[model samples]
Target: MPARAHKRFVLSDQPKKPVATAGGTFRGDAASFYLPDFCDSRAAFAIVLIAELTAIVLSIARQSAAVGFWGELARAALFLLWVGLVSAALLCWLRPRLARLGVGPGSVAALALLTLVVAAISACVSLLGHSRLVASAGTGAYFPRQLWPFVARNTVIGFVISAVALRYFYVTYQWRRNIEMRAAARVHALQARIRPHFLFNSMNTIASLTRSDPALAEQAVQDLADLFRASLSDRHQTITLAEELSIARTYQRVEQLRLGERLRVHWDVRGLPPDARVPGLMLQPLLENAIYHGIEPRPQGGTVTVTGERTAQLISLVVRNPLGERQAEREGNRVALANIRERLALLYGARALVKAGRFDEEYIVTLRFPYIASAPPAGGTRPAHAAPGSPEQ
Candidate 1:
C-alpha cells in the first residue's frame, strides 16, 4: 500500500473561528448567565469603596444641621456601609436570575427593585426610631408627616445612586470588550503573517524529501496537512497538551527529514499533564524558532531540548536551543515571541507568562501558565494526532 493510503487524515475542512464572549468573560449556562458581570470582584470592591468615600465627603460638606464633622462622618459611614452591604447581598442573590434575563430591561428592573427594597428598609428603620423619640417628647403626632418625606428622600437617593453605579459598570464592561477585540484582531493578523513563512519552509522541506526518500516525503505531507488543518481551525480555541506535543513531534519529523543528522530533538515532557489546555499553535512557533535559528544556521546542527514541569497551580514549559552564530544576528525572532506573549495575555490575563532570554551559548524560552484542563469532545475520543501514551522522544 502507498504510504498515503496507510495514513489516515482526519482533517476538518472548515473549522469555525472561536467566538469571544463579551467583556472577555467565559460563557456560562442559563442559570449563571449573569455571573460574568460579577466575575471581577476587585472591580466591584473598588466601585463600592469609591461610592462610600464619595458619600462620606458629601455628607461632611453639607453639614449645616446639628452634627460635628467627626459625628457626621461616623453617621454617614455607618449608613453607607449598611447600604453597601445590603446592596451586595441582594445582588449576590439576584445575579444568576438577572443573568438569565441578560443585560436588558429585565435585569435593570431587577436592580431597580433591589434599590427600592433597600430604600424602604432604611426608611422603616428611621421611622421606628423617630416614632420612639416623638412619643418620649409628647409629640407623637408629627411622626406621620416626618415619615413620608424621609421615605421619599431615601427612595430618590437610592434610585439615583443605583442607576449611576449600573451605568458605570456597563460602560466599563463595553470599554474592556472593545479593547479585547482589538487585541485579538492584532494577534490574528500576526498569526496569519507567521503562517506563510512556515508553510513556505515546510513545503521546501517536503520538496527535498520527495526526490530523496519517497516514503518519508509522503509522511511529511500528511504531517503538514494535519498541522495546517489545525492552524486553519479556530485560532482562538485551545487544545490539550498531548495534542500540541503530537503536532510538534510531527513537525520535528518533517524537519528531521530535511536536516538529517544535523537536527536533533530531546523532549522531556513526562512531568507535564497531558490534559492541560493551552492556546493552539502556542508551542509550535517556539519549536520553529528553535529549528530556524538554532539548527539551520550551524554547520553541525545542535539539539533542541523541550522540557515541561507541572506544579499544583502552574504548568511551565522550557525550550532550549544552542545559539548559533548566524541566529544571534537574525532580526525577526521578536515577532513570533511577541505574538505568543499577546495570545497568552488574552487567554489567561496576568496568570500566564512567556519569557525568552539567552544563557551563555543557549537560547531559552520559558512559558508558565495556570493549569486548565481541556474538556473532552462529545465522543470522549482524543483529538486528532494526539496519541494515548507518552510521545516519542
Candidate 2:
C-alpha cells in the first residue's frame, strides 16, 4: 500500500520576527517567559546614541534660536547616515570576515565584532559632523570634550545592547529544545500501547496446529518467535512501513497456517513510499480485530482487503473486512478502532489521523499522514523514499 500524504511540516514553532524587551515567547511574562534582553542591550545602545544626539541638537538650538531647526535636522541626517553605513558593513562586510576569522564559536564573535564596528562608525561620523556643523552654525564653538562624551555614552549603550540580545536568544533556544524533548517523550510513552494481544494470539494459533500438522506447527512456532523477536528488540521500536509490513506478513502467515482457507486475505497495496515511517506494529492490532470480529464470525468465510493510496497531499491507508449487518453489534471491533485513533493522535499530533465506519457492506478503518516520500533523520541530510518517480501533481 502507498503512504498517505499530509502537510503538517509547514507549521513552525518559531515566530517571524524576534521580540525585544519581554523576549519573543508567546508564553507571557506573567509566567516567567525568557526575556529578549540580549538584543535589548544593543537596542538600548542604539536608542541611547539617538537620545544623546537629540539632546545636543536641543542644546545647540537653545543657544542659537535661528539655527535650532538646522541643528536638529543635521543630527537626524547624520544618524541616518550612521545607520546605513554600519548596517552595510556589519551585515555585508564584517559577517563574511568572521567566517574566515576562524572565530570558532556560535555566531557570537561575529555579532560582537559587528557591534564594535557600528559603535566606531556611529561615533566617528556623528561626532565629526556635529563638530563641523556646530562650528559653521556660528551659534557656538565645537569642543572635543563635548563630542567625546556623547560618543563614549553611545558606545557603552551598544555593548549593553549586545549582552541583552544574546541572553534572550540563548534562553529562547533552551526553552524550545526542552519542549521538543518533553513532547517526544510523551509520544514514546504512548507507544507502549502495543500490547500482549499479538503474542497471545500467536501462541493460540500455534497451539491449534500443534498435533494436526507437526511440520506446519514447527514453522508456525519459528514464525511466531521471529515476530516476537523483532517486535521486542528495544532498538526496533520504530520501523518503516516496509519493515512493519514484513513483520505483519509474517504474523499473518502464522494466522493463515492455523486458520487455513477459513481466513481469506487480499492486499490492494500500492502507492506507498517505502521510506515512509509508522509506529511499530501499528497495523497488527487492527488486523487482529478484523480477524476476531469480522472473519471468525462469518460461517461461510470472507476476504479482508487492505489498501493504501495517496489522497491529494496526504497518504491514506484503509483496511476493509467483510462486515455486513454484523457491524451493528460489533462492540469489541469499535473499541479497537477508537484505540488506534487515540494512538495516532498521541504519536503524530494533528498530522496523523484514523477513522472507522461502514462503507456499503464492508467495515473499514482508514488512516492518513502527511506524505513525506523520504524523510531522513531529523536535521540530518538524508532523503525519504517515495514512488519511483515524483508524485502526481
Candidate 3:
C-alpha cells in the first residue's frame, strides 16, 4: 500500500523580515548609545540570592558582637530583604532606559549615576530606620555622629555591590556576543563551501541541456540566475517561509531539468503562517542532500515529499525520499547534516531540532522549531531581489 499524505496551502499577503536578536544591541548603529538590558529574571534572582547569602554570612560572623544571635539574624534578614526589594525596584524602573542609552561612554556614565542614586536612597532609608530605633530605646538620636557613620557605610557598600553586579553582567553579555559571532562566522564558511559545489553541479546540468533543448536551457539559466541572486543576497537576515519555499521550488525545477524523468517532488504545506521566518538557504541544502543521497545513485529517481505544518507553539517540516538499493553515505552527508544542526543550534538554541534517519526504506529529515512571527521592515517595503555581491553569488 502507498503511504498516505495530506496537502494544504495558505498564501500570505505580506511577509515581514526577521530581526536577529543574538548579539542584542551590539550589532549595527554603533553610534547609538543604547545597551541591552543587563538583567533577566534568572540573573535578578541570582543577584538576590547571592546578596542574601552574603548578608547571612556576615551576620553569623558578627553574632558575638550583638546582644543575641537570633536578634542579629532577624535584623540581618530584614535589612537584606529591604535592600533586595529596593534594588530590584530600581533596576526594573531604570534598566529599560539604560538599554536605550547604548553601551558606550554615555552608558557608563548613566550606570555610575544609577549607582549613586541607589546608594543614596539606601543610605537615607538605613539612617531613618536607625534613628527610629534609637528614639524608641529612650536614647537621644545620634543624628550627626553615629547616624553619619551608618549612612556612609551603607552607601559605600551599596555602591561597591552595584558596580560589581553591573560589571559581571556586562562581562557575561560580551561573552555571549562573542559566541554568537563565532557561530555566525562558522556557518558562513560552511555556506560558502556548499554554494560552490551547488553551482558546479548546476552549471553541468545547464551545459548538458544547452544543445539538446535551447529554450529549456534558457529557462534553466534564468532559474539559476534567480536562485543565485537570492543566495548572494544578505544571508545574515532571515527570509519569510513563503519566500524560502519559492526558492526551494525554483531549485527543484533546476534539478528536475538535469534528472529528467527520474526526479519527482511533492509539496504538502498546510496551515503555516506566511510570516514565519527561516534562515536563508536552510531548506536548499536539505533538498540538495535528498537529491544527492536518496535519488542520484539509483538509475530511476525517487519521489521527494516535503511537508510543512504549523501550530500555535511550533512549526515543523519533513522531507522524505526513497532510499536507493545501495547506501553511499559519505563524509559530505555528515558535514551537511552537522552544518544544518549547528545553524539551528545557533539560531534557536535548544528550541530547534533537526533529525535525519532512514525508516522503512525511506530517508527522512525533519526540522522542528519554535513559531515566531516576523516583523515588518522599517521602510515597509520588501526588496524585489537579493542584493548583489552576496557571498553565494
The best candidate in terms of lDDT: 1
Q: Candidate 2 versus the native: TM-score?
A: 0.47
Model 1 lDDT tens row, 1-393: 112211211110012212223123322234323323433587468647865796679776876355556666666666666676666666766676665555665457766875777577768656765776756886443223466677778788888877877766656555565576656656653554435666787799878878898898899899888887876777667888888898789878877877889999999887777887887888888898888888888999999999988777688999999998765544566767656665665576555667788889999988888887777888787754533333221
Per-prediction TM-score to the true structure, in the order listed: 0.56, 0.47, 0.54
lDDT (CA) per prediction? 0.68, 0.57, 0.64
lDDT of each residue in 291-375, candidate 2, tens digit only? 7667877887678887777667777788888784365666555555544444454345456766676677777888887665445
Q: Which residue runs does candidate 2 get wrong by more than 4 Å?
A: 1-201, 208-211, 233-236, 311-313, 324-339, 342-348, 373-393
Q: Candidate 3 at 83: error in angstroms?
A: 26
Count of backbone collisions in candidate 3: 6
Poorest stretch of ten by lDDT in candidate 3 = 1-10
The ten-residue window of minimal lDDT in model 1 covers 5-14
RMSD of candidate 3 to true structure, Å = 15.1
Q: Which residue runs of candidate 1 sit more than 4 Å off their true CA positions?
A: 1-179, 182-195, 326-331, 383-393
